[model samples]
Target: MLGVTSVDLADRRELLDRLEQYYDAVPRSGARVEDFGPLSLFIREGQGWPFYVRPTLGWSGSVSAADVNRVRVRQRELDIPESFEWVAETAPALRAAVEQAGLAVHEHPLMVLGPDVPAPAVPEPADGVVVRTVGPDDLVLPSALAVPHLAFAEPGTGGGAAGLAELGEVVRGRAGDGSVKRAVARILAGLTCVAAAVEDNTAVLGGCAEDASTSGRRIAGARPVAW
Candidate 1:
């Protein structure tokens, strides 16, 4: 594993640029876009939430409250949650615009592993456990997908109340949902990757990288690394 080190401005800017490019490609695959000068508003072709506003590609300046509101109004008109997403470090000025739009801004720590280094070795799974990447069509895919739902279903971190029965129920509940199809489409397009930590043929834990853009210069991280 790589050690922690102070990152310079060039490193930060390069990472942000790659991230911006990666995200910009994602919506184009399945969403409609409305570019508003300094920002681009993404609206999903079908559902919501994944849709958001981000700084326009190669746009130099920051957005204003008016710019933020333009996207917000479109969101409201379309009856979707008004959402904006971006790296705080990359677009410091956008925060004020978001706040001025009467929206609460929440910050989540970005854990970006520097990609220009050698890839770390994959660690062994727990004893008797197997860790490997899986395709969307795998039999246990639904269960793997269920992990997040079950995990968030329980509030605190005092271990879970659920088990195999609950997991099976989750899988069965959404039988006809288009999740499998969507997963297949995305994965087949080289846009998504899913990992499973399986023991006794069940997915006890899962991880995923969706809509990844590995083109251009290699700042290189695997499904495990990168932002």
Candidate 2:
């Protein structure tokens, strides 16, 4: 049993690494990469604000007053195009910076899953629901996979469409690159549930779950889905 668990974890890790690589490769429009020696940053132009990602840290960036003002100025300089969002890990330095800058701080917990754990019990489909695995050739699959958790999310705090698209790109890229082997999709009553499994034959490294319900439906009694 212990050996089986180890193999599961390994598989999860491999999938996660591949997903990270995919995100690193696909650049977003107006997205900029900043290298801070110990960290790398991905910044994108958003609808109302700029979106940011720190794949290395596994956390989203909070806005500082400085960041807030800087972004505002940039928007004007860039002709105030569209809404934007930013992301980063909640490190001490980052937290302090955002706080000192007078930007409100929002917290999002990072979750992970491993192979020793049992597979998520298949969810019951709602009326008129259909579930299917998204194939690699389906370009729309990536966009669909990228939808964020909106029902359990706070207002102005969820990763909207662009964020979801980014996520989908990562999942597809990793799976295609031999970093992941198994990915699943569940759609019930016109809503969707997606899970990405990354593991070797033995252990699971990590997994992520997304509830894609148009009516903001959620999976009740569902365990933490791996990512």
Q: Using lDDT, give the best candidate's number.
A: 1
Model 2 C-alpha lDDT versus the unseen true structure: 0.39
> Which lDDT values do the candidates have, in the order given?
0.74, 0.39
lDDT of 2 at 164: 36
What's each prediction's clash count? Answer: 0, 46
Residues 1-227 of candidate 1: C-alpha lDDT, one tens digit per residue: 16545576566677787877776776676788898999898888742125888888778876899998888888889888788889887788999998988889988777676537676797767798877788867887777776667776776545587888887888788667766667778779877677878878888877676654446542322333110
After superposing candidate 1, which stretches have Cα over 4 Å from the reference? 1-7, 46-49, 116-123, 152-162, 211-227
Assess the local accuracy of residue 106 in candidate 1 as a C-alpha lDDT between 0 and 100.
86
Against the true structure, candidate 2 reaches a TM-score of 0.38
Compose the digit string of candidate 2's lDDT tens values, residues 102-155. 556666654444446786798765444334444444333433333322212335
Which candidate has the highest TM-score of all? 1
Clashes by residue pair, model 1 = none
